[model samples]
Target: MTSIKIEHVVHEKCRIGESPVWEEKEETLLFVDITGQKVCRWNPKTNQVVSVSVDAPIGSVALRKSGGYVVALGTRFASLNWEDHSTSTIATVDEDKPNNRFNDGKVDPQGRFFAGTMSQEIRPAVVERNQGSLFTLFANHSVVKNFDQVDISNGLDWSLDHKTFFYIDSLSYAVDAFDYDVNTAKISNRRHLYKLEKDEGIPDGMCTDAEGKLWVACYSGGRVIRIDPETGKRIQTVKFPVDNTTSCCFGGKDYSEMYVTTATNGMDEAKLAQQPQAGGIFKITGLGVNGIPPYSFAG
Candidate 1:
């Protein structure tokens, strides 16, 4: 087994830090503070952190080929000029469900952006269930509904061959797979890849390594588990000091380093004192594994 060490990335911290992405060109890390309404960039080399404020709660962000970012802004999909903090709408949904907002998201191999919505009532548990849906935003400025009846739609990644898509709906407490058609950007053959036991916390955002192993963040379980998706078995577990490990992604010059985000949401003063680093960014290394670069939105 490989050894690992975790370190804290000191910053002002976030109320709920999530959705970490690596910008290869700049050699910097990008992430979002869901409830804090900002997207931040951290440079490990200079130890500099900068951020831009968004009007609404920013769920996630992916780099856009068109010279900006595509973000999940509350009830709409919008283009954000991170440099100037300007935004324009791409598409909107969940008008009927006033309490719904976009959650976790990513760009697929085809350059299409995929993001999901969930009820805003989520705290310790899902207050409203099955009211969320997964949405796709194409470069042509068109929106399509892929699936619905989802609660707290989160964590998404594709396989090495681009033939399989992995997803997680937090309430389900499991990782699921779908047969993917990269050219058409369609997914099918839905099946349960693996389910976490009750002791394991709800699964949140996840990423896959170059070796195709799934690394899942356990929200209340205080650890990230590496699973071999093919065998549907657990391979390793990396514990965290905080219980709210929200999301993770692989980055760094060679994609060998892992960056993780945590949250302070729903934690009381007493709970916060115990895990003082709950809302800070974390870096893990020495895993002896490498990861893939995130796809950018073609639009």
Candidate 2:
């Protein structure tokens, strides 16, 4: 196994830090504080952090081709202005399932935004029920449902060839692969890629590396494990000082650095003392791997 170096980069201690997106153009990291209702940017060069407040809880954010950002805010898809810190409605979804809200998501190679909703029960703790659905936002601002009965729609990425779609429904405690069509933004033939052991914790946000392997963040497991998608076995493990590793992404000049996010939502004072770096952003290096550039929302 290779020795990995993990450092706590941002120490703000967000309520629920998730969705770490690397902005290649600006050379900064953009992440969302779900319960804090804010979008933040961290510049590695100067160690400066800039945050924009949103009206509602934000699930995830992706770079927009036209300009600014496309966000999964609450139950609606909206456009965020990078400079003025303003947002405009793009589309609304899941009106019938009022108990649900958008969760983790990512952009496709063809510029479509893929996101999903999880039950509001995600707060405090998740209920033993599946009432969420996955959705895709086309460039025309139209939203389409892909599937439902998801307990917590999280972690999404595409294969190196763009033929396989990798996903995780946290409650399922497993990773799934699907045949994906980039041109039509449709996914089919879902199959289990791998299942996490009981001690590995629930799988949260994940992304693929340049090598086509998956790096998954474990919510209560306190570590990030690298898995070989082809053989469905563990390749490496990166342990964190905190147990609530929410999400992660590759950034830095050469895309060799992995930025991870953690949360402090359910931590009590005693547990918080055990992990003072909880709810902060972390950077990991020395893994000897590069990452794929994140796709932007063409819409």
lDDT tens digits, residue span 103-186, model 2: 898999999999999877645447547888899999998889999999899999999999999999999999999999988988
Question: How many pairs collide in each candidate, listed in order?
Answer: 0, 0
TM per prediction: 0.97, 0.98
Candidate 1 lDDT over 129-158, as tens digits, reads: 999999989989798889999988899999
Instruction: Please state the error at residue 87 of candidate 1 in Å.
Output: 1.1
The residue pairs in collision within model 2 are none
- Model 2 TM-score, all chains together: 0.98
For every candidate, C-alpha RMSD to the true structure in Å = 1.1, 1.2
Q: Which 10 residues in a row give candidate 2 its minimum summed lDDT?
A: 120-129
**Model 2, 287: alpha-carbon shift in Å?**
0.5
- Candidates' lDDT values, in order? 0.90, 0.91
| Superposition-based RMSD of candidate 1 using all C-alpha atoms, in angstroms | 1.1
